[model samples]
Target chain A: MIAPGKLARLVATNALSNRRRLALHTFGLVVGIASFAFFLSLSMSVRSVFLEEIFPLDEVEVVAPRVGAADVDARDALNDDVVNEIRQHPDVKEAVPRMAMAFPASGAAMFMGQRMPFEAGGFADGVDPAYVADEDFADRFVDWEAEEHEREACGPPPERECGDHYYCDQRDNTCHKRVPIVVSRTLVELYNTQFAPSHGLPPIDEALEGMLASMLRLEIGLGETMFAAAMTGGESPPRQVEGMVVGISDKAMPIGVTVPIGYMERWNREFVGDEAAEVYSSIEVVLEGREAVAPFAGWVQDELDLSLADRQGERFATAIFIVTALFVMISLVIVTIAAINIAHSFFLQVSERKRELGVLRAIGGTRGDIRTLVLAEAALIGVIGGLLGVAAARVGAAAVDFAAHRWMPAFPFKPDSFFLFEWWIVAGGIACAVVFAVLGGLFPAGRAANMPPAQALSQD
Target chain B: MAGDPIIRLRDVEKSYGPASAPARVLRGVSLEVGSGEFVALMGESGSGKSTLLNIVGALDVADRGHVEVAGVRYGEAKERALARLRNVDIGFVFQAFNLIEHLTCLDNVCLPASFSRGKSPAEVQERGKEVLGRVGLADVAGRKPGTLSGGQKQRVAIARALFQRPRILLCDEPTGNLDSHTGGEVIEFFRELNERDGVTLVIVTHEQRISSAAERIVSIRDGVIEDESAGAPAAKEAAST
Candidate 1:
C-alpha cells in the first residue's frame, strides 16, 4: 500500500548503503547478459553467412541437363551460341557463357603449413576481360611481376617474347603464352575446407586465395610440341600460353577452371573445330537486380521449360531460427542464475535490515509496506544490473567482431560481420534481466512481510 | 468527571512461554485512560508495566481480554484497521527512541504519514516541522538521529509520535537514556504538552521522581495493579475540564 514515491525513496536509501553488494550483483548479471548477447549476435551473423552462401553476388545460375532431352553429349557446355541467344531476350541483362580450356600452370610456395600452388591447367572460366575490370572485381592476378618478367622473357615482340602466363618448358627455346583465368570465391572456400585438411594445407583467406590464383600459369598443350601432330586430321593445335588468374567472381563454372572468352575461342578453334559454339550445357542469365532475378529465373524456367536450379536461399533461414532460438533458450539459463543470485542477496538483505524493518512497522508502516520496500530495492537492482549487463554485451560483441575480422578473414560464408546485435536483442536482454530480478525478489519480500512486527522489532 | 475512557480494557490477561505455569506478565488487569489525562505507570523491573502499555497502544495482543482503543475493539479490529488506528489515533515512544537512523529528524516525524496515504507530502512536512518545533528541535529537523544527543533524539522521537496529532501518546521510559537534567527537561516538556495541548499522556517509568511529575500514578507489583493515587493540581484541573 505504499506510494510509489515513498517506495522508491525507501528502496534508494537502503540500496545506497550497499554499493559493494550492488556492484557484485550487477557484475554477475553482466556476465550472464554479455554472454547471451554475444551468442545471439553470433547466431544472427551465422545465419547471414548461410544466406550469402547461395549466391555470393545475388546471381543464381540456370542449370543444364534438362529434365528430358535427347542427344545431349558430354562436350556440351555454356557455349557462346547459347549466351548470345539469352542476351537477345529483352528481360535478360547480360548472359555470360562459362567454359574452361586445358592449359598449363605451375608454381608453388608454402606459407603457414599450406602449399600455395599455381595449378597446371588451372580451372578456368572464359569471361570478358572488360568485366574483370569492373568495381566488383578485385584483381586476383599479380600483374606487377609481369612487367619485371617481361625484361626476363626472350626479348621484345620482334624477337618473339614468351607471352604472359607462359614460359619455356625445355632447352629447345620454344615459348608458350599463359592464358588468364578467373577464380571463384566458392572454390577458395572449398580448397580451404574440403581440400586443405587432406592435403596438409592451411586455409587461405581472400588475400591468400587471390595470391594463389595470381601465381598460377597455364599453357594450351602443357608445353607439348607434338600437340599439333596428335590433333585430328583437319584440326590444328591451339597456341600454348601461360594462364594467369586475373580476377575472382561470385558465381563460377562449377565443373572446371575459368578463363576469358578469347582463350576459349582460340582453344576451341584448334581442338574442337569452328562449330564449337553451337550447344551449351549450362547458362547464367543476369537480370535487373534483387527485384528482377527471382521472377526472371522463374519466367526463364517456364518459358524455356528447361530444368533450372534456383538455390533456396531463405528456406534454411527458418531452420536456422529454430536452432538459434534453442541457443537463445539455453542462454536464458544464465539469466536465471543471475536472478537466483539476486534473490539470495535479497534474502541476506532482508535479514540484515530486520530490526530497521521492525522499527518501520512500529511507526505505522503496514506489513505490506515493509514487503514493498524490500521489493522496491530489488527492482532497482534489477534495472541497474540489467542495463549494465546489456552494455557489457555490446562491448563484448564489438570485441568479437574485431577479433574475427583480424584473424578469420578467409572464413567461408563470410558476411560484413560475424556478430550482429539487433535492437530487439538489446531491449529483450534488459527486460529479461529486470523480470528475473523481480522474480528473485518475490519470495524474500513475502518472508519479510509475514514476520511478526514485535518479533522483528525485538531483534537487536 | 474524567472524559469517557478513550482506551478501555476489561480483565486483560497476558502471559509468556509455556501455557502450564507460564510466566504471567499481566493478570486480570483492567484499566481505563481518559482523554486529556497525564497518567504514570510505575513498577519494578519485572512488573509488566511495559506490557500493559504495549497492549493499550495496540502493539501487542492480550491472551484474554476485551480491549478497545478509540472505540475499535481488539477482538474485532482487522490487522490493517489496528495498524491504521495506531497511526491515526495513538502514538508510541519507546525507551530506545526507535528513530530510524537513516532518516532525518523531520523525515522520522513524517514517517507515520507515509503510511496514512491520504496526507500529501507538503502537508506531512509542514505538520512534521510544526511538531518538531513543539518539541523545540525544529532547528535540528534535518539532522539524522545519530548526529543528535541522547536528549535531542528523545525529543525527536516525541515529535515523531506527536505527528498527525494522535489522540493518545503512550511513552515507555521516554527519558530513560538521558542524563538527569536532560531527563527532567524532557519530562517538563511532556507535562507542558499534556497540560497546554490536552494530549492524553500515559508514561511508564520506574523512577519515583519521574512518576511524581504525572497527574496520576498507578503502581504495579508482579502482574497486577497494587495502588493508585491522584492528588495533583493538573488532575484537579483535568477533572474540572
Candidate 2:
C-alpha cells in the first residue's frame, strides 16, 4: 500500500513531466467533451421551447362535438359539473373551464395617441385565472371586479391603495372596474414576424414585454361589432367595457383576447341569457406530466363524452425527444472514440515509463500501487480536460448565440440563446470525461503494474 | 558464519526460457550466512552470483528447493509479504546506482518509505536526511542524481537502501562503476556499517580489494559455487580472538 499523498505526488510528477504528450492526449478528450456538452445543451433548449411555448405537452384541450355531428347529443355540453368532474380525476392536475363571448363584439385601443380599431372583431374568451398565474407577467392578470370586492371589505379609503394596472377613482374613493385581459404569445409572435416588418414598427423585445402589456388600453363594445350587427336587437345601444392588457400568456386564445372568468360571466349574463353564461365552451385539463396526458385525455373522452381539440402536442413532443436522443447518441459516439484515443496514448505512455515503473516496484511498490499511479495520472488529465472542454462549449455556445441573434430572422419561439447551460449538463460532461479516461487507462495501468521488478535490476 | 543463520538456502535452482530448452542460471546450489556476518560472492559474468543474490534478497524466486531470509520462507510467502520484506527487512544497492533521474536525492532515498503505509512524510524525510548524512551526501540531498558525480550518485543509492534500516544489505557489485579511490571509500563505508551496526552483508564482487574487507569469500563458476575460503579479514579477526 502506498500513501495517498505520495501516490498523488508521484502521479503528478509523471503526468506533468511529459507536457507535450499530456497536451496531445487531453486535446482529443476536450474536443469530445465539448461536442457532447454543446449538442446536449442545444437540443435541450430547442426541446424546451417546443414543449413549453409552441405546443405544451402537459395540457389537453377538451371540447364538445359540434352540433349535428354523427351520434352527437345535448348532454355533451361542458358546464361547471363537467369541469369539477375532470378536475377531480386522479391524473388531472388542474381543469380550467373557458367560455367564449356568445354575442358579437368589437374592440379598439389607443396606440401612439391614435385610435386603432380591431378589424377582426372581438373574438374573446375567458378562463380560470390559475391557468395563467405562473406566467412571467401574471402579477396583474387578476379580476379587477373581484379584487374590488376584496378591497371593499378592508374599508374603502385613504388606507387602500390601487394595485398594479389599476386606477383609484377620486370621485368614489374606490377602485373602479377596469377589466384585465391577457393576449396569447402566439398573437405577439404573429405581430412581431408578420405585421411589424410591413408596418415599419420596431420589433418588441421580450425583455420589455411587461411594458407592452401595461401601456395598452382596450375598450370592448359588448353587443357591437365591425363583422356583423348586434344579435340582441332589443339592446339600448352597445355598452362599452374598458379593459387593460395585463399580460401575455401561452394559456390565452391564440387569435383573440382572454379575461378572468368573472368578467366573462358578468358580461355574458348582461348581454345574453343565464344559460349562455353557465355553459363553458371548452376545458383545458392540465395533467401531471406528458405521460399523464394520454390516459387523462382517454378518461375525458370515455367518461365525459369530450374529445381533445388537438393532438399536435403529443406528436411534437415525441419528435423533439427522438431528435434530441439522436443528437445525444452522436455525441456519445464521439466521446467513445476519444476514449479509444486516450487508451492508445496511455499505451505509449506506459511503454515509455517501463523502467521507471520497474524501479518503483523494486522500491517495494506492489502491482496495485503501480496500477493506481497510472490510473490516477489519467484521472488528473480527465479533470483538467473536462473543465477546459465545458468552458470551450460555453464559448462555442456564446459565439453561436451572438451570430444567431444578429443575423437570423425574427420568428416564433426564437430564443435569445440556442443553448441552455444547466448545472447537470456541465457536471455530466465532466463526469463523462473522467469515466471515459479511466476506462481508457485500465489496460495500460495493468501492463505497467505487471512488469517484473527484475527488469529494472538487470538494467545497467 | 559467526552467528545464528539469518539466510538459509538448500539445493536451490533457477532457469529461464521455455521448458523445451532452458538456460539454468542456478543449479541446486546451497549456502548460508549467519546473522551480522559480512560475506562476499566472487564470480565472473554468467557465473550465477547475481542470480543467487537476487534470490536471497526476495527479488527473484528459486525454481526448486528451500530458501529462507530472516525467519520468512520464500516459497510459501505471498507477493505482498515479499514486497514488505524487501521494503522493510532487506535493502539492495545496485552497481548502476539506479536513482531516478527526475527526483532529488532525498526523494529517491524516501522512495522505499513511500511504499510502507502509516509513515508520515515528515518522518520519512527526516529519516531520509539522516541516511544521506550517514552516507556523507547530506549536502547533495536536494540535488538530482544527474547533477552528482558517480561517487555521490552511488552514495545516494546507498542512502536510499539504508532508508528503511534493514537488517540485511545486498550489494550487486556496488562499486563496479566507480574509480579505485571511490570504490575503496565505499568498501570502507560497508565495513564501518558491518562492524559498527552489526548489519548482515552479502556483496557480489570480483575485486580482490573488496573481498579483502569481507570475512569470507565464496567463488562461483558456471552456475555453481566452486570454492569457499576465509578471507584475510576473517583470518585476522580469528587471530585476534
Candidate 3:
C-alpha cells in the first residue's frame, strides 16, 4: 500500500547506505555491458562498410555467362527484353541494363597542376540513367549528344559557337556538348587515401569534392589505346571525346567511369558493330527489400540462367552477424555471472538486516513491500552500471580510433571509426543490464519477504 | 473492565519443533483485556508471556482455539488481512528498540504510516514529526538510532509504534534493554500515553516495578495463567499523574 514515489525514495536511501558494496557489484555489471556495446557497434560499422561502399547488397548485378561457358542459349543473353522481364517481377523494384565499351579506350586529367593518366580498355561501362536517378547530380547525368538535334558549326577548332556547359570537338570541327560521367565514391576514396599521398597531390576532401564537377575534366580517347596499338591490324584512328565529372555514386563502376547508355549505343555502333550496341553486358536488379534478395537471386540464376556478379556482400553480412551474435552471447554470459554475484551480495545483505526487516514487519510492512524494496535497489544498480558501461565503451572506441590512426597503414575504404554507437544499441544494453540484475535479485528478495517476523527478530 | 473486550482468546494452544517431538509453549490458556485498559502479563522466561503477546498482535497464529483482536478473528484471516489488522489495530514496542539503522529517526518513526494506504508522504512526515515531539525526541528526529542514547532509541521505537494510532499497543519487555532509571522513565511515558490518549496497553514483563504501574496484572506459570490481581498503590498514583 506504500506510495510508489516514497517506496522509490526508501529504496534509494537503503542502497545509499551500502555505497561500497553496491559500487563493487556495479563495476562487474559495467564491464559486461561495455563489452556488449563495443562489440555490437564494431560489427555494425564493419557491416556498413561492406553493404554500402564495397558491395551494395540491396541491388544485385546479373551477368549472362560467356558463350560456351554454360549451356548457351540466345534467350539467356541480357538485353532489353530480359531487362523488361526482370523489371516486371513482383519483388523487383527496377532493372537497369548496362553496356560496356566494346573498343579500347584511355583517359587523362589535369588536377591541381598534376596530370594523371589511366588506361580503361575493358573498364568503362554505360549505365541506364535510372540507376543513378536517386543521386543529387542526376539532372546533369544525361545524354547530351541525344539532346542536340543538329551539331552547331562555328569558326575554328578551339573557338566555336558552343553553348553553356558545352565544348568544341576539334575532330568534327563542330560544337559538341561535353558528356556527363560518374565515378564511384570508392574511387575517390582510393585517390584520396592511397594515390594522392604517393603522387604528392593534395587529397580531395568533401569541400574539394563538391567542386569536382566544374574543376576536373577528362579527354577520353575512344580507340587506339596503348593496348590496341599492340594489336595486329584492323584498328581505327583514335577520336578524342570530352567528359565532365557529374557526380559520385555507389552505383558507378569502381575502377572506371559510367556514362549514359545513349552514348554507349552510338559509340559502339560507330566503332564496333550494331550487335555490340544491342547486347547488354549486365543488368542491375534492385529489390524492394532485403527479404526478397535470396529468392530473387535464386530466380535470376535458375529461371534467367544469369549469375549474380557479386554475392560477397550477403556472405560478409552473414559472417558479421554470426560474429556479433557470438560476442553478444559471451557478454550475456558475463552479465549472468555478475547477476549471480549480485544475488550472493543481496543474500548477505538480507542476512545482516534480518532484525531490521523484522522491525519493519512489526511496524506493519507487508511481504510484498520487502520484495519491491530489494528489486528496486537492484534496478538502481543496473541503471548506474549501464550508463557507466556506455560511457566506457565510447571511451574505448575513441582510444581504438586514435591508436588505429597512429599505427595502422592506409588502405582503401578504411572507416573513420570502427564503432557505430546508435541510440537503440545503447538503450538496449542498459535494458539488458536491468533485466539481468533483476533476474539475479529475484530469489534473495523472495527469501527476505518470506522470512517469519518473530524468528527474524530473534536473530542476533 | 466494561463493554466488549478489544482482545479475546479462548483455550489457545501453541507448540514449536517437529511434529514427532513438539515443545508445547502455550496450553489452553484464555484471557481478555477490555478497550482502553492497562494490563501486564507477568511470567518466567519460558512461560509463554511473549508468545501470548505475539499471538494477540497478529505476529503469530495460535495452534488451537480462537483468538480475536479489535473485532477481527485470527482463525479465518488471510496473511494480507492479518497484516492489515496488525497495521491498523495493533502496535508493537520491542525490547531491542529495533529501529532500522540505515534510516533517520524520523524515517523509522514513519515506517508504519509508510505501509498504510491513502496518505501522502508529506502528511505521513508531518504526523511522524508530531509523534516524535509527543515522545519528547523531536530534535533527534534527524539523528540515526546509533547516535541516540538507549532511552532516546526506546522513545523513537515508541514513537514509531504510535504513528498509526493503533487502539492496542503491545509491549514485549520494552524496558528490558535499559538501565533502571531509563526504564522507569519509559514506564512513566507508557502510563501517560495510556491515561491521556485512552490507548489500550498489554505489556509483557517479569519486573515487579514495571508491573506495579498497570491497573491489572496476570501472572503465568508453565504456559498457563496461575493467578490475576490488582496492581500496587503506585497504579492509583500513576493514574493521578
Q: TM-score: which candidate is best?
A: 3
Ranking by lDDT: 3, 2, 1
Interface Cα RMSD of candidate 2? 1.3
Query: What docking class should model 3 receive?
Result: medium
Model 1: per-residue Cα lDDT over A216-301, one tens digit each: 44333432334334543434533334555555565555434565566565555555556653444356666666566667666655
Q: Where is model 3 chain A poorest over a 10-residue stretch in terms of lDDT?
A: A227-236
lDDT of 1 at A96: 64
lDDT of 3 by residue, B201-233 (tens): 999997887788887899988889999877774
Please list all clashing residue pairs in model 3, or write none if there are none. Answer: none
The C-alpha interface RMSD of every prediction is 1.9, 1.3, 1.5
lDDT of residue A428 for candidate 3:
91
Q: Where does candidate 3 chain B have its weakest 10-residue lDDT segment?
A: B230-239
Q: Write down the TM-score for model 3.
A: 0.93
Expressed as tens digits, the lDDT of each residue in A1-460 for candidate 3 is 6568878888888888878988987987899999999999999899888887787777888888664246565433878888998988999988888898877778887577677787765778899786788888899899878775788775454455677556677677677778888988888888888898999988777788778877778778877575554431345566777788888887888888899999998877767768888999888888898888889988877887777786888889889999999999998888888899888988998898888877777777788988888888889888888998888989999999999999988787889999999998899989988988888889989999999788778735
lDDT per prediction?
0.71, 0.83, 0.84
Model 3 misplaced regions, further than 4 Å:
A67-70, A73-76, A148-171, A226-235, A402-411, B1-3, B233-241
DockQ of candidate 2 compared with the true complex: 0.55
Q: Using Cα atoms with residue i matched to residue i, what is each candidate's TM-score against the true structure?
A: 0.66, 0.85, 0.93
